[model samples]
Target: MASTHPEHLSGSTADYSVAVPKSMFPGLFVLGMVSWTLVEYLIHRFLFHMKPPSDSHYLIMLHFVMHGQHHKAPFDGSRLVFPPVPASLVIAFFYVFLRLILPEAVAGIVFAGGLLGYVFYDMTHYYLHFGSPHKGSYLYNMKAHHVKHHFEYQKSGFGISTKLWDYFFHTLIPEESHPKMQ
Candidate 1:
């Protein structure tokens, strides 16, 4: 397994602190986690999956850098998680953005939640590819849905942790009709 450490994410000289009521942090964390699902869905559907023009080499390269590589090699373990270097940048951006738009305590809580959400999403994504789940189990179904996105429905089934957003956005992949095995 490849290390997901954000060794390159260090060296930031900024010092920041936010004070939040200890009692509220848990709820705020949960909210942050929940918010991450929507964020993940949006980024995946709109940004990562964006179709670059066939004639634009730069756009193609950008697409591959952002996500095309994963589609091309879905089982590459090292590439499965967001490399900490880039991920830290995005995480910082979100933290700063949240702090600017909301109260510091609220922002911190939500940011933490969102961060946890990203961790879960990455881990679950890896598991879906590499872990074997029992048939008819939740992970099994999730794995099936994800595999379909990779192999069959590239334009749909963008949801990984949950399919709620796909249903909400009407991007859910339609079930295929198959002859029952004898």
Candidate 2:
């Protein structure tokens, strides 16, 4: 039988991280998660979708590596989660950027929070498609929204884990098309 996996995704499996302590040690991790969610939304809507000059095929490839692969292979279950090494690299890069602008401790905390948020966003996205979120749950709705982006409309519904930004920015899908459960 032919495999139903998404062909564009990297074939390497993600090495998931171990659980951090739930106490203060993990607080930065949690903060990272939340901060990353908003960052994810912003990056998805603006940077990921940006149409660059046609002359620079390299730029196009970068975009594809960052996001186009996911759009092309939306149903690819394995591609949903960000691999740990790349994710850590991205976090470190952003942490340094934040450090330059804000106080060291504040930047450190915010960056940590953002990374934690990213983890949750990645897992939630993967779960939306692969895991079973019961009908009428928030996650179920998010799954529907994301599926819509893949199948019906790619121009909108970029928010996967949360619609707050989509709603705020007027990118949300119309209700008439994807109706909510009663």
Candidate 3:
């Protein structure tokens, strides 16, 4: 399966750090992870699910390559997580962006937290696609939500890791209807 090595991520982002005091790490880390959820939801909803111009073959192909392919073959494990190179490019972008906006120590820890959130998102996404969770559990619910998004609610239910964004954005997939039987 395509995956990012955490060691590489830590190594690359290390340059953006200067010596984050132990006291500030937890808060900065949590902030970063919280920031990531919004980013995840936004990217999934806007970019990955964007509809290209009908007349533009290039954009259409780009959409397919970026995300449609996942919907087309949901169970393809290798495609579930991004390969290291592309993932690193995006990660680096975040690191640099955060560095510009925040102190070095703060930015590094925040970036690391965001990166950890992303890893969790990827793992949760893969599990929702292929794992069996106990009925009524969080994963079970998320799996149902994700499958619905794939099969019937393409425009809603964009949150793969956590439903917090979906609830906030009001894009949640409505509850499934089941007809009553005598």
In terms of TM-score, the best-performing candidate is 3
Error of 3 at 75 (Å): 1.2
**Per-candidate TM vs. native?**
0.82, 0.72, 0.84
TM-score of 3: 0.84
How would you encode candidate 1's per-residue C-alpha lDDT over 1-182 as one tens digit per residue?
A: 65545543344222243466799889989999989999999999999999889999999998898798999999998878988999999999999999898777788778989998999999999999999999999889999999999999999999999898999999998987999999
Q: Which stretches of candidate 2 lie over 4 Å from their true place?
A: 1-34, 177-182
Q: Compute the lDDT for candidate 1.
A: 0.89
For candidate 3, the per-residue lDDT at 82 reads 79
lDDT (tens digit, per residue) of candidate 3 on 127-178: 9988999999999999999999999999999999888999999999999789
The sequence of per-residue lDDT tens digits that candidate 2 reaches over residues 30-50 is 666666767888888888788
Indicate whether candidate 1 or candidate 2 has the larger lDDT. 1
Ranking by TM-score: 3, 1, 2
Please identify which of the two predictions, 1 or 3, would achieve the higher lDDT against the true structure.
Answer: 3
Q: How close is candidate 2 to the true structure, as a TM-score?
A: 0.72
Give candidate 2's root-mean-square deviation (CA, Å). 15.7
lDDT of 2 at 24: 52
Query: After aligning candidate 2 to the native by TM-score, how far in Å is the CA of 79 from where it should be?
Result: 2.1
Off by over 4 Å in 3: 1-22, 177-182
Off by over 4 Å in 1: 1-24, 177-182
